[model samples]
Target: MEGPIEIRGLTKVYGGGFKAVDDLNFVVPKNAFMGFLGPNGAGKTTSIKIITNMLSATSGEAIINGINVMSDPKMALADVGAVVETPEFYPYLTPMETLLYLGSLRGMTNTEITNRGRDLLDMVKLTEWKDQRVGKFSKGMKQRLAIAQALLPQPSVIILDEPTSGLDPRGMVEVRDILKELRKIDVSVLMSSHLLNEVQEVCTDVTLINRGKMLRSGSVASLLNEVKAHKIEVRVLSPPALEVTNQLRSFPGVKEINYMSDVVFNVDFEGAEAEQAGLLLQLQGMGLKVVSFKESGLALESLYMSLIMESR
Candidate 1:
């Protein structure tokens, strides 16, 4: 059997019936690099804890493989490796110590633990600093150490919470690469990130949630395809906003216009890119100042914002 992830009626409630996750449902096919996305306070972390058996869910059920998380927390965790909410480790523990400690908790013998821990450290590029106390490590270095420790159990499923939250550009690349390597080893990954570009970089599929409810779930390509809308950028030499907007409203393909900045506007188009030239010509013919015009690809940030706004 593969590392299929299943969630059924997963719900979580806090004090006074504040539902953290409400009736969420989805499945990440085996070996999937699934992105779990939501804004802050959207219950991403709470849901992850329940799935990993760290916190008992208020109700509902979840399973990885055939392991019932609520009924068999130990066995359910046997093949799951997770770095949740900024990984925690003893400040006195070195990278090596952290992995060894995790290995022991997983019930591996010392020899087996040492061998696997070394390999993981090497894989995460932490071999040189394995003996150094984690307290002395940089943020990126500590994050790498967390990854190494997560792999010590040779888990089939890996979950990372905001894995790139506080990372620099280079640190982000390191964490992304580590995720890619995990796929090579056939480990399924479930990652939560508010960074749209970061999630777009590594996730094949995604499940978006808001206010404790599942909002969307599907392949990235499929999700994008669902949005048939296109956008174009128009830069006028020197034009007035209302006049230009009114003029654009009469164009064949233009649906709406969004002012990007001074002298820049993004025109939403219902037609194709080939029609953009005609639209610009129409502007010029109307005696409106025209400096530059070009087509713009849909931005994930824009897409997410639009979706969320429309939902409300």
Candidate 2:
């Protein structure tokens, strides 16, 4: 019943009065896929370093599940798996051997290591390459292996920093697919990323930060729904005529319309729920077969850009 992560005034400062993280506070609930969002130099990496004990906080406390990381790091991190950045592997070692070594370091017995390692390799879709040298694997493959290693202990909370930072389109897709699977297993995850689309696709909740400060935090759906005005994409069954396009503009509550194609258009509208419903009905009454209507704006991107500008 406990939340997986909590922070109170987590501040980090360097020698010359550079505050990397400033009075940050947030809590990630149990099994929450929380996206820690920010631009470069926004203290995301610095905060993660403090949580994993890579660096000491200038002030404040970070608690993981019920253990205070600052006071009892060993116990606090016992059930936590973190990948702060790109993890390197012994190129000569195979996936099986690599995991065996890592497991031995964690005091896992031979039987436990073998069994768990096998399962982890399978989970990361590397079962076929278990005996293959890691040196032959691509960057995406290595990243997957890193993730499997992070889950070796079956940790309750997983912390990832820029998990898909640099990779080909295919690699990025593969990693994101794996991240989506984590939610099905009920693992709490905190992934940091500056990419809005990536976070929007993979995270259910988000905490946006800028210049080492918290800007907003909430559920993705709720945040998107909170926007007062929206750019809506509408697709009709047939090519819309000039008169039909003109009719779209004259619709109540529609501020403007941009023609995207014969059958598609984007409408900027400011309206309440009831008004929107009425507008849709009016469009249908105009003899246009509506195929789809949905918000076209990327709400997270909009929010992130606005907050960053305000912080400046």
Candidate 3:
């Protein structure tokens, strides 16, 4: 059950000499749920395609466990399961039938398929729908089935691209719950998504990419800590006037303010530790009843924007 996915100096050049992935280098640790993060067209998908052997890299290497994908894709990817995008199942096939067909293609015996299929269906909470036609399933149900399909081969590492993309709120939650379950099973998952919150919630580590270049790679906590910024949530006894709100925004160290409710709001403050401490005092001095004040972790959205802007 080896799970490390290593990429060294990987590069992908298109016909017009545009490089989609430029000498990217990183490693998804064994049994780590790592997020492959980037803006659209930032080579996230291209790098993943190279790893899955769907697209050939112009140069460099992708090694899964100890085997090189470029040298021998079959052996390297034999234990890898990937859901690059939403896959369409046959309209008439039941979940059980679809899995059995897929399992047979993978050279599993009928007994193996039946036993493993049942386990996977249960894992995905699809036991009740196992015999139901896929045509009647919702987008979320289809996604759950897709995950079951990926697990049928007992892969140690699962690669998913935007697994929650295009789903409704409930569907997103369903998919996210499944990802959380994978973490409990010691299955390394490399999931690519633009949703920063999703990565923050589901991934232990992350590799950030922009314009075919690696921006940062580290544990989520470490990355957030590295951001030399502060977001503070403040609660007041009552909402302030327009002028008072404007005054806070125009403060020397305050970068932005977002109203959460009548008496609560969050502010992005860029200042030293001393300045942050003085902010609450300053608000109180302005005749506002500052009920509570605390520094919040840098939001993934803010961190991402900061990095993206800095990269640009």
Clashing pairs in 2: none
Candidate 2 per-residue lDDT over residues 7-120, each given as its tens digit: 789999999999999999888888889999999999999999999999999999899988889999989988888888887899999998988898777777888978988988
RMSD of each: 2.9, 3.7, 3.2
Ranking by lDDT: 3, 2, 1
Alpha carbon lDDT of each predicted model: 0.81, 0.86, 0.88
Cα deviation at 225, candidate 2, in Å, is 3.3
Q: After superposing candidate 3, which stretches have Cα over 4 Å from the reference?
A: 1-3, 233-252, 256-266, 271-275, 291-298
Cα lDDT over the full model 2: 0.86
> To one decimal, what is the Cα RMSD in angstroms of model 1 from the true structure?
2.9
Ranked by TM-score, the better of candidates 1 and 3 is 1
Model 3, span 76-176: residue lDDT tens = 98888888878788989999999889888778888998899999899788999999999989888898899999888888888998899889998899889
Per-residue lDDT of candidate 1, residues 75-185 (tens digit): 887888888888767889888888778888889888998888888888888889989888878888888888887778888888888888889999989988988776677
